[model samples]
Target: MRTRSLTSAAVSAALGAALLAAPAYAADGVPPGQNPAATETTNVTAGSTPTADTPTGVPSGVPSDAPSATATPSESPAGDPSPDPSSSAPAEGTGAPVFGNVGSDPSDAGFLTVAVSSDSAITEVSAKLTQRHGAEPATVAVSGFTLVSGTPLDGVWRSPRMSQLPSFGSYDVTVSARDSDGDDTSASGVTTVDVEPKPVFADRSISPAVLDVEHTHVKLSGRISLFDPISGETSPLGGKELGVSAQYGYSAVTAADGSYAIDVAPRLNGENATSVAVSLSFWIANPDGTNTYVLVDSKTLPVVISPSRIRLDHSSVRIKYGVKASSSGVVEYLYGGTWRPAKGVAVDMGYYAKATSSAAGRFTLTYPYLLSGDTSFTVGTSLDSYLDDPYLTASHAQFKVDVINRTSICFCTSWLDAYSDLHIQGSMNGSDGKVPPNRKLYLQQSADGKSGWKSLGWFTVKSNGTFNLDAYVSVPKGYWRLYSAGSSDYQPGNSNSVHFNRTATRITGFNAGPEPVRKGRTVTTTGTVQKLSGTKWAAFGKQRVYILFQAKGKKSWTQLGSVKTDTHGHFTARFTAKQDGTWVGVYLASGSYVDAESYRDYVDVR
Candidate 1:
């Protein structure tokens, strides 16, 4: 092989000294010409005459400079710039040595290259294999290649250029050729074409850290970059897949430019505060049997769920009533697509109990269990459903009456009559103690079974216990029961029922007056009246007939007349209304008979 090395010059110097010491000669022992071996460029032609520089008795008996007598110019020819005494021909070798540029096997031959691009496109390939085998110089075989491994080689198997194999890996190429004896030889070489895996965006994030439990809406935004191990450039991660998920299994994808965003909301079933982390991954493969995947190289974002801002207030105009709750733990209602506080608002003691000072708008809700009317309240909190397991809700809270009753009265009088006045006062109490102030009180009483129970009046309780009532009656002679009705300040249904009786001494009958007569028309009115006897109507009994009457345009009237009556000596009348307006008539017992109070009358006219 006509090869050149850095040490070739020194070897030439030593060759000259050997040539001077020994006489160059053939086996014939003749003197060999000492002219430095001249390199002759020859177009050696078979059967042609040798050139002038051709030497006799050389190997193959063909001079080294004889190109006209050599194979065609297309054939590979050896060259020698100089010859010394040390230069000698082979000692009659046996047969031609194996000499083609290729691998060990005929089937193992091809080419390997690499691909590089700004966006995953192949860019360049290796300069064809320049290594040599024996005297024949090797080349990136363009044809006649076979694959002992990797891609199969055919008549025209193509080499993997720098572009085709964009990923990193090892590539094998084989080239085969045939010698004069018709023996096929092949050679293969490995090339490493590595294409790095770029970075991909995993997910996005939001500012202000955690998402509070009461927080409904949140803003989403973040950045992404290619995670290339080989280079730190921000390469495009187009067509890549990404995911973002939270405690409730919420997830999102990235854009072509590696940017990603997502909105985290409460699950269909509401929850508590939570913190979530985002992640990313990238994958790539190479021709040399190598692969890679990067984790979180681009960017890591976080999602925070803040607590919900729940405001509970009294739904009723009157704040004196109790409220009812719908749910338990982490109670919430859907408001404007987000979770809010439950209805029937009430003070949450668990929250207020915390040492953290409550803000101005902060208030507690006291749910009504037994009180009348609608009332409730709510407060603001900072917590997310995700972080905490069983979130704060109606079920988790304990509800009780907010306002306690404190004012009540209980008094017993020694002397009581129609002419005497009575005064009574006191304060109310709860299971604990005297209830809070500002509550109202009421008084109720039932007259001797005749008038029944009736509400006297309502009054506000003052710091001092003082209240008065006039006990004057037209005919005072009966029993009475007194009590109070409940309110925000007072509990309905009195705890105790008080009773009292008046002296019995009534035995006088009024005059049997004339019946009412119309203005211009004559109307006859007659009746039998009763006499009050010892707190009872004794003269008013069976066997008596009485006519009661009232004048037109009058609210009060009396018994007109009476007769010895019914089964004994009964009486009747013919009455007429001379004018329009209202009137009343009654027929009662005039003689001795008990409980005869049935005949009552009423009349109206236009």
Candidate 2:
């Protein structure tokens, strides 16, 4: 029985190869663990593999503790370099077990894997997992290594995983092997559960989700729970900095109970008040540099300025944008209820009035294009979904600022899929607040805007300014916009664009084990759909996953069957191999995620 570390100086001196920090990887396509005591360079004679039942002595660079991802594996200062295992005389006449790769899988978080091979019949192999937390230290056993291929003594082992670790530190791992002859030998190594502090926040709401632009700052307060939701582990984030930001930023302190409040200033992208999108991001940050809140909610918000901040003299084409701001470009002013960027693809603006502020909070639009003369005035609108400034609230108001001879058409959209017609609806209005009779609105779609828009269907404006039409849309996978080519006096126009994104999930770690399975024997196929949960791969469970197999004679991959992932985000299926081929899993996009294909797992059936 002996234990030692593997130092670069020693490995290089013996093997003549650069002995860098080589981390042994595990499952999810990572090779199984390796025996620490096993020499990197072997001198066994010929094809007849041989082994020693006992250690020659301790070797170089065995750390006193387990290896950590954050901490480099360092050699013990007291460790004395010794000759390679080949130089030591065997302590026993019986051939020892030749251990295979023994390492931990980074994806699995805190699991170590060991595969062993031996010259003699292997009776048993054991792995010890040690965790030290302050004065209290604990240990556990890694299980599920199935012997595949060759004799039981000289077989390949895979699919070994570790249990939930008790602490957040390094794990010392030691693997021992006993042969049928009752001879024993062991290999020692260390691994760690040093994962980044994962932050998962619970939902919280502000006192008033809506506000007025006149208010410089609005109170944004919420309760948060920092923890690994899937792991059911609570993360203590008592004193981390939390912030909400858009064009501007604000900060707050997380209370001991995960509560925090900050006054955030909402900065709109335009001059006249419009609905602004605001987000509270990285509300909490971990010491490991991990943060949460990937997709912040840009809910219904309006930062619209009342009394129509934009004074437009249509005859002279003079536009004065006035808003009270410490600086210009601080808030986006909107003349129309919605602010449509003038530079969108194939965008034909009948009337566009939107600008940010200047140092004096005054904006004058001298742009020659604003005078196209189609409407009396424009209302301010949100740039995207919500306002970034806390002071801004949500508004949808159409106003007239000047007396001008004008013809205009404006509309909104809605989807009705539950019915057979697949009907889409919209309401059009003019500057006079009257519905124009016999107006025509066409539905056009574009996969990419560069390719000219294609008309799908047309809707005749109703007497009430409403239009209804049903278009056979299989999936709303592309952008759809309403098109008005313009009637006698009205100008050509396109409505706001809409894109329905198909959600998708990603799959990884598709593995078929008992690597070398015999023909006609069933091998366990295990895998995971590696979904990101606050920067770490968390198991997405209770979802339908398809098992696909492609054999030599098969023309295409056929669905063998399906399986659901466990709470731990793992799925397993068993199949008897008739011949050698490949196995794969297809995870159909569930709610929130789109469809994904797992990495191909090749099964070698002998």
- Please identify model 1 stretches exceeding 4 Å from their true place: 1-240, 245-250, 254-259, 262-277, 282-402, 406-481, 485-606
- Please list the Cα RMSD from the true structure of every candidate, rounded to 1 decimal place: 27.1, 36.9
For 1-606, candidate 2 gives per-residue lDDT tens digits of: 222334434322322321111123322222123233332221111011111532322121111111212222111111111111121212344455555445443223333434444345666767776753446667776555544333454443333333355543445666666666566666555233332223334444543455453444556655544333124244445666655654566666778876667666555555554555555544223233332232222344655453223222232232222211110121233434653222111101113434443434433332223132333323332433442233333322333322222233332333323232234555665434555443678877788644568888787777887766667765565556677765443445566444433332455667876777899889788877655444354677887789988884464787888898888778889988877666877776645554555655557788
Query: How accurate locally is residue 324 in candidate 1, as Cα lDDT from 0 to 100?
Result: 34
**How do all models score by TM-score?**
0.30, 0.27
- Candidate 1 lDDT (Cα, whole model)? 0.32
Ten contiguous residues with the weakest lDDT in model 1: 113-122
lDDT of the candidates, in the order given: 0.32, 0.46
Residue 342's lDDT in candidate 2 = 22
Report the C-alpha lDDT of model 1 over 177-276, residue by residue, as the tens digit.
Answer: 3323223333334221222332323233453343433443333554444433222223545455544333344445557765655555533234433433
